[model samples]
Target: MKATLILVGTELLSGGMIDTNSLYMAEELNKYGIEIGSKITVKDKIEDIINAITYGKENSDLIIMSGGLGPTIDDITKEAIAKYLNKKLVVDQDELNELKEKFRERNLKFIEINTKEVEKPEGSVTFKNGAGMAPAVYIDGIVCFPGVPIELYDMFPKFLKWYSEEKKLKSDEILIKDLITYGIAESLLDNKISDIFTEEGIDYEFLVKDFGIIIRLQSKISNKNIVEKIVEKIYNRVGDNIFGEDSDRLEKLIIKSLKEKGKTLSVAESCTGGLLSDSFVNVSGASEVFMEGIVTYSNDAKIKRLGVKKETLEKFGAVSEETAREMVLGLKTDVGISVTGIAGPLGGTKEKPVGLVYMGIRNGNEVEVEKKVFKGSRRKVRERAVLHSLFCLNKMLKRK
Candidate 1:
């Protein structure tokens, strides 16, 4: 099967907002052996939307649209689709009542503009939105979802299941595995396991993502023995770099390790701000293992908060191994991690250039410090520094 994604929003064209719903839909549909023929992003104009729909229908078997399904006046996506399909727009009474009740529960006034969320093209199948007031619709091989990510995420799966069953679409019996690795270059990783994918029905690909390298192995025959042998060989070649498998996040793994060992963690940040702590708190149940996080961006704050000595900051200039060690040692937790770096387009010296970082990890009486010089923009440097800090913490946890 083939499909085209129609993403409608003026913000997307103007670079005010990014379109992530199309990427999510594409990935989900690919799992069922569906090919995406094209992705079209149009503005909030009715003429542009109709043109996109006309183009999508000509090139693909199905059209999936997202955006312009809101209470605002610019939301004319349904009207355009109705005009293209020659159908009248009618409001579903049940959905309208439910939407009103939702507003009442929140003690907000329900206005007439909100009625647009319940309106759909004639003879279309409507699906309830669990995350918001909007209802998704399907008519004449075209599906429409709300622009919000959470609403689309909640409704797309249900719609896919119903549509798949209604059309008797069978999923491909494909076996896939993802081995995630960090702290290694992609070229070197490919070189290490280049010769392992010679067997029939076994395919492999490498994706260099922001987190790390993903070695994806797929088997068309669904043969367990062949897949296992290939995986074992790859592991033997570069096992030390592999951290987790499919859908495994670094922060989640670190939290799991701390819980398993009955240990607590604390973080002291400099260049990364609160991003290092924010990553941990984003995971569920992290409160059990996370004690506190302190951001000491200035030298005075470092001296007062993490107890870094004034003399140490003056000597090492805040982004050095000595300052990092002192920061981690002052945390007083079962496990302490500290990050100090110059993630900058400015404030770089001849001795300490931009993207130069020092990470310190303290486990009981032992303390280890690492110095690294990364390359990238300011945001990229900060993000990479956070990941490296977690990697160092994971290694320290493994030792004990």
Candidate 2:
């Protein structure tokens, strides 16, 4: 099966809001072996919506649209869809009554404008939105969803189930595996594993993302044995640089490893602020292994909070390896990590340029500090610093 995605919103074009719905939709559809042929973003105007739908219908078997489903006047997705399909709009009384009951349950007044939320194209199938006011409607091979990300996420599973049954889709045709790797350049990674792409019935692509490089291997035949052989070859070539597989996060893996090994960790941050700590805490069950974290943004905080000596800051500055080592050593845990960097468009000197980072990892009596220089904006530098810290920590954890 093939699909086309339409994202309709003036805010998306004007940079007022990001369009995240399409990515989620594409990934979910791909799980069912539905190929996304194209994705179009258009303004909230009816003409643009109709044109996009026309293109979708011409090129793909399924058309999925999101946005402009609110009660406001500018919300015209359903109107354009009805116009394109030559259908009349009608109010679904059951949906309207349910929406009103929901509003009343929350002790909120039901405004007259909200009635527009239940108006679907005549003879179309409608699915109630469990997370929001608008209902998703399917008409003439197109599915309409509210632009709000949470609502689309909540309602996508129901749509997917209905769609698979209606189309009698077999999901075992295409299979994809994603290998996430860090601490290696894309060109170097390609040099190591590029030869394996010549195997029959398999396709490959490399994606350069902010965090790392993703090696996506797809098999058209869905032969598990061939896919596993190719994966084994790639692993043999790439080795430890391949940190995790599909949907595996480095922070979450670190937390899980710590729990398995019966270890606790703490962190101190400088230019990275609290981002490193935030990543660890975002994982569930982190409390079992995460002991404490402190953001010593100032020299005084480093000296007072983490017990760094005044002399060390004066001699080597706060962004030096000496300061990072002291910061990690001061923390009382089975493992301690520290990051200090100069992430800047300013506050850079000849000796300490922007993106110069020092990361320290201390496990037991052993400690190591690494100096790295990265390139990008301030946020990029800070994010890279955090990723580097996690990579180094992972290496330490693998040690005997």
Clashes of 2: 0
Q: Candidate 2's residue-wise lDDT over 1-400, tens digit each?
A: 7899999999999999988788788778877888899999999899999999999999999999999888899999999999999999899788999999989988989999988888888999988798988989998799999999999998988998888888888666678899999998999999999988887777799988766799998876557788888899989999789888998888988898888889899999999999999989999989999998999999999999999999999999999999999999989999989999999979888999999999999877889998999899999999999998898888888893
Model 1: lDDT equals 0.90
Give each model's clash number: 0, 0
- Give the per-residue lDDT digits (tens) of candidate 1, residues 1-400: 7899999999999999998898799767856656789999999999999999999899988899999999899998999999999999998788889999988988999999999988899999999888988889999989999999999999999998898888787666556778999998989998889888898777789988887889998765458678888889989999888888988878999999999999899999999999999999999999999999999999999999988999998887899999999999989789988999999989888899999999998888889998998899999999999988888778777888
| TM-scores vs. true structure, each candidate | 0.92, 0.96
Q: Identify the runs in model 2 with alpha carbons over 4 angstroms from their true place.
A: 105-108
Candidate 1 residue 66 C-alpha distance from true site, Å: 0.8
User: Model 2 scores what on Cα lDDT?
Assistant: 0.90
RMSD of each: 2.3, 1.6
lDDT of each: 0.90, 0.90
